[model samples]
Target chain A: MCFYIVINDILKGLKNQEHKYIAQAISIVENNSSLNKNLLLNLKTSSMESIKIGITGPPGAGKSSITNQLIKKYRFEDKSVCALLVDPSSPFTKGAVLGDRIRMRDFYNDSKVFIRSIASRGSKGGLAENIDYISDIVEFSGFDVIIYETVGVGQVELDVVDSVDTTIVVLVPESGDDIQVMKAGLIEIADIYVINKYDRKDSDKLFLTLTNMLQLADKDKWIPKIVKTVAINDIGIDSLKDELAIHRKHLIKSNKGLDKYNDRFIKKIKHRLISDFENSFWNKKRYEFLNSEIEKDINDRLDIDSIINKIKSI
Target chain B: MCFYIVINDILKGLKNQEHKYIAQAISIVENNSSLNKNLLLNLKTSSMESIKIGITGPPGAGKSSITNQLIKKYRFEDKSVCALLVDPSSPFTKGAVLGDRIRMRDFYNDSKVFIRSIASRGSKGGLAENIDYISDIVEFSGFDVIIYETVGVGQVELDVVDSVDTTIVVLVPESGDDIQVMKAGLIEIADIYVINKYDRKDSDKLFLTLTNMLQLADKDKWIPKIVKTVAINDIGIDSLKDELAIHRKHLIKSNKGLDKYNDRFIKKIKHRLISDFENSFWNKKRYEFLNSEIEKDINDRLDIDSIINKIKSI
Candidate 1:
């Protein structure tokens, strides 16, 4: 398939909830490590405009409000901005007051602002395998900035944020406590921390605590600025932008962002290959066989080692 | 360099906190989807008596204490059981309390009880590569049952335990209340449920809850027996043994264990081969050239696609 058309199919597949095709596309994005003859040519020919900004935070830290604000700001800059919010599909039925797009509906009607909601669809990472690929497609669709809005704070979210140039961590006044709860994962990953709901009375106390914590905890000298933003009123959005600029400056000056991007590129390649290797080895047929094997051994009573030797002999 | 010698070095290295070998062993385990001929032969030749079992539960559910009870049970069993408690490894500090062994030190004179506490050295999965290799070594040393213990639960742990003939899940009185938390990971994985600390006031309440909850869930049709064990007094040890025998009888009679064993065997072989293929690719002088290309591009802030192309060319 032509690269553009292939990306379109992926988008259509995601939109239609075609799980298998979505999985396949994600595999491709992850394995973009391979320098296929066709892919390289596409890269050269494709005028895919992309601004991939990754956002993540622990639950109840107001990441959505920050995303809503960021998209609005980018819309002010230009009309073409696509925001893709990846939601946790597993926990879907539990409760959701505002699904991604609905939560940020103010700019939804503005043709300049394109918003899409994606269910996580089994990938532990907030954004799945082909998300970056999808982001590229939207960017090429003429969006100025491709904003990746991830739902929760976990290893996978941290990983995605690190892969991008701009990694914004959303926090709240009470997030200081969560920061302590989640320091090991968060402290190392964030390029900037936005204290959402900054109008809260304890916001100042939270800011000082964050700074002190950063100083004591970090040795590589990554003290991400704690930007305060009352996202509901959009009070600190401009300052957040300034902090982003400053952070982006430090990233370029230190060449740190470039280093991380390279690392991610390498990782993306390896990860895709590894997962594919697993998928092929344990595809439907293998899964069926495994299920039967499980039935005979643990459930139905079979000799475990002998059954294994049977497969190995095959 | 030999398999037997390498296994010895691994244990000794871990004992002394010299972990280069562990990292290498981990690299092998991490590649679960593939394995090659030479590596298999090496592991096979160096094989030791490792009794593998599945230990699973919900988060913060006292798996560590249950693990201690299991080891303590093994010491009572024959004094020839080497207990390996895997996972629930916190990286912050090298925790000194080998919690499982501390509860089971009755074998001071019995040199046969070799206990080692293992953590997920890198990823979330407790045992993947090294544990298998470590099991091989311990088996060669002739421990009767190489009791493989896992704390807390997940898919990977379930997969590892599925490789064994018997699986045990240790739970407390509160397990009934939190059964929902474990249904996905441990619900179907365990062959037996050891409800430790039956002396606790609410043990009956917990037991009733477990029965009611188990009835509510579809357990892939296996009604795994819930055996109550007051481990502090070594209660129900005989019944646990009798139940194991009964399960083993069914296993030998049904050929079910053999089939599941076959599934695991096929997987392990694939894991070995995949690792070999990638290692050979990256270990060559070619990898350095690829690194150089990536370094130049990243450092010079060139495009990612270009560096990928350079690496492919090398």
Candidate 2:
């Protein structure tokens, strides 16, 4: 499985910036390579030329609708757009695939647009872990920008996927799990919260509640913006885009993203390492340790402390 | 953490269970005492007499309720019953809270009943990695039988919790995520699944689904009995008790519990080893190997095969 990285090396050997960027990324992802590692590291040190935007919302929250509108607007200007859709992993857990694709059926065959849907396979970091790598691939593949669409709510999903320069969380009237949003952590993580389906009468009440919650929170110069949109009719998308651009501009000016990306990258690596060990970790060293620990007898025999230490130190 | 274990002499002090039978098994779970470890080497080998029942289900499944019922029933018989609740934890992400205590309001006042909620606290095993030591704290306190209640549903929880003689999965109908029972591995591990809230219309449907799913699996000989109960009303309490006892009789006759306990003990220790190593091994070890591979620029850095090997080997 590891030897497939040869394809990636071959691509590097035949290096040409004009090559289809998507193909290059596909090779890297499919073929495990030394080059792939370098590519990831390079991305970490690179720039904000291709501004990434994240469009995410829970089930029935109009995230895809907003993303579709953004794609259309980008298309109208003759700009290349890439939309990456992340489907809920447990197909039965949540019905987030509520016609997200069929709704944008008209643009299915659009040559200027690159649409890709990734099914999260229960990886703990959710879709977030793959986002940066995939984003690099999409951006280098000739797309001016990429829009990452995420399922509204996921244990590990919400934060991990394509971390855009700007993150927009789509919400709706009568949003369930209000307490969840108000929770200190969730509220702090969200940069922008969009109240989609705003044309409805109940939107005002929801807006008021959310506002109250925000006002009550302790803010030290970080105030997540609330944008209202009726995505179905293509309303408020331009302002939303403008807001996203402004946020990106803010990030670059403050250099906040530099530290944030570094921290996230390190965290991602740690998460992946832990996941790898937990899932497998059992060829020989494990068995050797297991034998010694057992010979000690669990109740009093095994020096669990020492055994655990040996494993950790390994 | 390793030093803390030996400095306290926690292992030797807890293994003073020579005279009492239940004390031995209680020590196994409480301290998570490693069997292979030599603590039991000095003592005479003898079997313990205690009813150890494991209670499990998905996140919202009414396991606490069933456990509470069992405690009440055993109390009615004038038997000392200890309730051990396993709480999940991982400080790196969202640390799960201990919530069953509030739900178990009435059990607190009973002198004959001892209910202690066990939090993993980022411990290697979500179960007491120290095992017998912790269960010793509960058992040497002199409770005749112990009921282990676990939260949510997952392979780890089932495997760790099912060391008990009888495994019971308490479930509810009209669940938002009942389908998880199908997608997840619960259908196999559960020895008996109690459909709590039996008055709901979906109970019969859930039962049929479970039956159909199990029948299709290869474990044709291990037919897990399905019991329906309304824990709130204490309906079918006698029947549930009868089923549990019958299952116990069958297990003793078949000598399955002993094998299960021993097998589970080994696997439990290994799981702890993997988790502990995973927590720190990335920056701890992988960077050197991965960096060297990338530095040498090995085209086929041999990732997948190495990943499989690295994980297995670690």
Which 10 residues in a row give candidate 2 chain A its minimum summed lDDT? A176-185
CAPRI tier for the interface of model 1: incorrect
Measured against the true chain A, the candidates' chain A TM-scores are 0.74, 0.73
iRMS values for every prediction: 8.4, 8.9
Worst 10 residues of 1 chain B by lDDT: B40-49
Relative to the true structure, how large is the alpha-carbon lDDT of every model? 0.55, 0.58
Kindly list the per-residue Cα lDDT of model 2 for residues A33-123, writing each as its tens digit.
4345344423322346566777655445667789889989888888877787765344332422435556667686777776766544334
Model 2 TM-score on a 0 to 1 scale? 0.56
Report RMSD (Å) for each prediction in the order shown.
9.2, 9.0
Winner by DockQ: 2
Task: Provide the TM-score for each candidate, comma-separated.
Answer: 0.56, 0.56
Candidate 1, chain B, TM-score (2 decimals): 0.70
